[model samples]
Target: MEAYCSMKAQEVRKLIREQVITGQTSGMATGFTQANLVILKQEHALDFLLFCQRNPKSCPLLDVTEPGSYRPAKLAEGADIRSELPSYRIYRDGVLAEEVNDITDYWEDDMVGFLIGCSFTFEAPLLAGGIPIRHIEENRNVPMYKTNIACTKSGIFEGPTVVSMRPMKAQDAIRAIQITTRFPDVHGAPIHLGDPSLIGIDDVSAPDFGDAVTINEGEIPVFWACGVTPQAVAMQSKPSIMITHSPGCMFISDRKDSELSVL
Candidate 1:
């Protein structure tokens, strides 16, 4: 795992293309911006875009594809949406049919893919700040929870906001807020800090999606609006056709993480 941990973006894609990497891609491509994949039909493009805008906290706008465009022009050049990602979920009228290593068979002429930002891009900064990401340290998926907070509505896409939790000490939590605020395009800043129940999270030990991490005493839970929001929202809407990277598997982009910085 350590050998693959420092792999290049192209190398990571090769593993994904060859179906060699089956698990989550949280820490594989260190410096590159790993994006959340969302594919939809042309008809839902405008509505979904607006939903992303209205709920920018949960859905920061990234690169959107033109109708029938599978290749992302802004994030990763010469990258295929079908094969670059490790795993994809096929949603039929809002129900998940099955998980697959690729999605070439379901491709449509009017399908457009989106590459939204993910918090995985910020691990470099957080670790530099001496804040340990529980999942990365534990070799497990980051804990994600569905919050009681409702996302701002835009057209047909609307649902509860979902957040990823990373337990940190009080001082580290403050530093995290400062560090993340610099990267607004990647779901900047912590939306909620401390007390899981305050944000509709009943138990910190359990998560709606992903594996749970141990929270040490004197460390508080910090929550950030996650890239998973789109998948959760898209599932509820159930468009005729919608595709997303399976949880923990993300699309590796050619763009550097620092390029996403506002300052």
Candidate 2:
């Protein structure tokens, strides 16, 4: 993993494409942006794009590949969306049908791949800001939950907003908010802090997705809009076919964290 982190985004992607590194991409390719992936048929693309636009915090649009094209022209040159991510989840009629390391077998000529900004892209800045990221410290993927909060519906896409959690001291949480707010493309500032239950998260120790980490004394749970929301919405809407990077397995991009930062 150390070796991979030092490599450039394209190199990390090549390894993923060749099945050399099949694991969560949480801390990989350090300074580059990592994106959440969603692939839907061309017919569903416009509606999905509108859904993303309606819910920017959770589904920040990073890049969208043309129909049937796996390459994300703006995010990463020479990257293959179908094979670059470590894992993928295939949903049929809104239910997860299978999980695979590669989607080459399922690619369709009319499919449009959407690359949504992921919170991992902002962690480097948070770390630099002196804010502790529990998940990365624990060597685990950030915890995520499906919230009771509903997202605005667009065409056939609609579902509860999802959030990723990271527990931190109040001061650190505040600093994290200030730091993350600068990278709006990557989920941005926390949507909620202190109480997990208020956002419909019943248990802080047990996450719906990714591994749970300790919330230590004097620390509060911070929640951010998650890229997972799109996939959850797709499940509820029951798209005839939908594919997404399995939770925590992200598509690392060539774009730098500095490039996406506003200030």
lDDT of each: 0.87, 0.91
The digit string of per-residue lDDT tens for model 1 on 61-117 reads 679877897888888778898888989998888899889998899899998887788
Please give the lDDT score for candidate 2.
Answer: 0.91
In model 1, what is the error at residue 169, expressed in angstroms? Answer: 0.7
How does candidate 1 fare on TM-score?
0.96
Question: How many backbone clashes are present in model 2?
Answer: 0
Root-mean-square deviation of every model: 1.3, 1.2
Q: Report the Cα lDDT for residue 224, model 2.
A: 97
Q: Pick the candidate with the highest TM-score.
A: 2
**Residue pairs with backbone atoms closer than 3 Å in model 2 (clashes):** none
Q: What is the lDDT of residue 101 in candidate 1?
A: 93
